[model samples]
Target: MASSASSLTGGISAAEWDARVNLAAAYRLTALFGWDDLVFTHISARVPGPEHHFLINPYGMMFDEITASSLVKIDRDGRKVDDSPYDVNPAGFTIHSAIHAAREDAHCVMHTHSVNGVAVSAQEAGLLPLSQQSLGVLASLGQHDYEGIALNADEKPRLVRDLGHHTYLMLRNHGLLTVGATPADAFVAMYFFEAACMIQVRAQSGGGTLRPIPQPILDGIKQQIGQVTRGVTPGALVWPGLLRRLDRRNPGYAD
Candidate 1:
């Protein structure tokens, strides 16, 4: 088995190291916010190397428990090239790889099966624009039908097509996924997406007629979010605070 420190530091540039730390921080925050589904879901970031390789959590580790050193590096074919005792989740990679291979802009990808996310996904109407939070996510969201288990290589093409040019994706009967130019961007997108789902579910449970946001107002809000949030990039102002919180709770993810 590869030593944790060597596997994480070896062959990784400073930029890659930064990415790994940020992605690891995202996993910790996601778990903190109750978005993790134990060891079931994943998030991945492209390593800043010639091979276009990526890093993902070791299969058995819960998101909260994933350290930067515990993340596994793998090629596009999902073969582990790093020395680690843990195995990679092939199904997790299938969804992430589809986007990374197809969209050069996607440097990081995150997926979750949180209760609210899956609940909204199973709804026939899917993510109604009932709240401001939902509108923020809906403006940039795309939907893809769930194809049962994502183990088949053949599903990559369709998955890529469905996620075309969108940052957030609602997997029908499955969960939520988001892509970003950086790990922070992906995490922010998922944060908003998950919030939207949670709000929708809670509102629906109140047993009242839903009031959808006006289309013109919704469009305006979308523009405002883009302008104010600066293209919805996650590294904006919120990420640093999140990282600090992680450090306080769990310290460095690198082992």
Candidate 2:
């Protein structure tokens, strides 16, 4: 395959094809939530192998226009490993590649600069424990201070250091990033993360005394989640419904 629309498989596994569909769906879903920063931020999914290859959007395409077959496969250095007509934004790949290199479980990494996400990032407190949505984010969140544009390779260690074992990373003065073993998991985490940021920004603008949730409640959020959803995987339950919704509205992502 020469990396046209038919490259959705391109000698990849059935699992890889499914990953492509989900990753493409995620791109469209980002558009659905209006979280995309045009062609700036990205969502990358690692191909299931020891080779460190990953799949990212074909640059120059809007998130909503991304398709399963059109994603470009690239290496850790952000160089294209498979043929594609699109040229990737190397600077954008820096952050994604850094996280993918650091976290083995982070098969899927999503970054966004949505209004609330960037607004929350600029806050000194960095995602306060106010709303229940924030509690979900607070459960396993890490924050990294802004380091200007992500064009430097030296930022990788610091970013990995700041991220540590946390599932979510809040880039101070930048935006939100989430990691998941699957695209759906990352998508679900980001949904909660963005919602939390949106709620915090709205609450702060209300011009009233703000109340942070008690620390004890924050600590028990994970346990509470298991109870609330009966321990079902967070994304697994909701992802199908999301795809159905997308199918009804904009159905080309799976192509």
Candidate 3:
């Protein structure tokens, strides 16, 4: 593992190596949580530098199988910037690139085609405020209409427009997206985003009237979250424990 880690980090800056480790952990954690859709979805992190290069999972590899060394580095155009042995799914990079190019704060962009996320995205009401988890996301959420398979570059402007300054994005009839200053931020944000969807789906299935959180309470969620997190990103507080969990469950992402 040490030898492999050295090989992957050989020429990259320490910042890039750190980004690679975090991004790889995000991928494995996605799979651990059953949020991965084969290799169809993507989680991308901007390479920390002046250039607009990014790291994304290698194409055709299961999310649980991705490691720091295997993630492919690519430019904003989805062109490979590093000579990685693995290929990337440019179509998967479409949403990620659009967000990254538009929002500097979006250091990591995570998209998931998880069952519950897609189910909620397909709903007409779209993420009803039936759960506490929904409140945090509703405070800063955006919705984008699906434009086929996301293979066309023409859809970029519209995607960026819909995602303007928001942390969570629901792709109508598709899935969910979340962006953050780091992979930890994005991963934890998606956790709440997907949790809300899961609760919504189950509640609807119970065939009972859903009690929505009151608007007055929902309006104050941002402040409430700030207090809860004490002005720190939620990920900053949560990531270390998450890494410990990952180490016990699915080790080797760093390699």
| Candidate 3 positional error at 140, Å | 0.6
Write the residue-wise lDDT of candidate 1 on 1-255 in tens digits. Answer: 435657557766878778778888889899999999999999999998689899998899888877777788899989998678999988999999889999999999999999999999999999988887777777778889988989999999989888889888999999999998888888888888998989899999999998888899877875677687777454666888888888888875755
Record all residue pairs in model 2 with backbone atoms less than 3 Å apart, i.e. clashing.
none
Best-matching candidate per TM-score: 3
Q: State how far residue 151 of model 1 sits from its true place (Å).
A: 0.5
TM-score of each: 0.95, 0.96, 0.97
> Candidate 2 on 91-205: residue-level lDDT in tens?
7789989989889889999999989999999988899998988898898999898989999999999989988899899999889999998999999999999999999999999
Clashing pairs in 1: 68-253
Candidate 3 similarity to native, TM-score = 0.97
lDDT of 3: 0.92
Taking every candidate in turn, the Cα RMSD to the unseen true structure, in Å, is: 1.7, 1.5, 1.6
Residue lDDT tens for model 3, 38-105: 99999999999999999998898899998988888899899998786678887888878888999999
Of the candidates shown, which would achieve the greatest lDDT relative to the real structure? 3
- The global C-alpha lDDT for each of the candidates, from Candidate 1 onward, is 0.86, 0.89, 0.92
Worst 10 residues of 1 by lDDT: 1-10
Off by over 4 Å in 1: 230-232
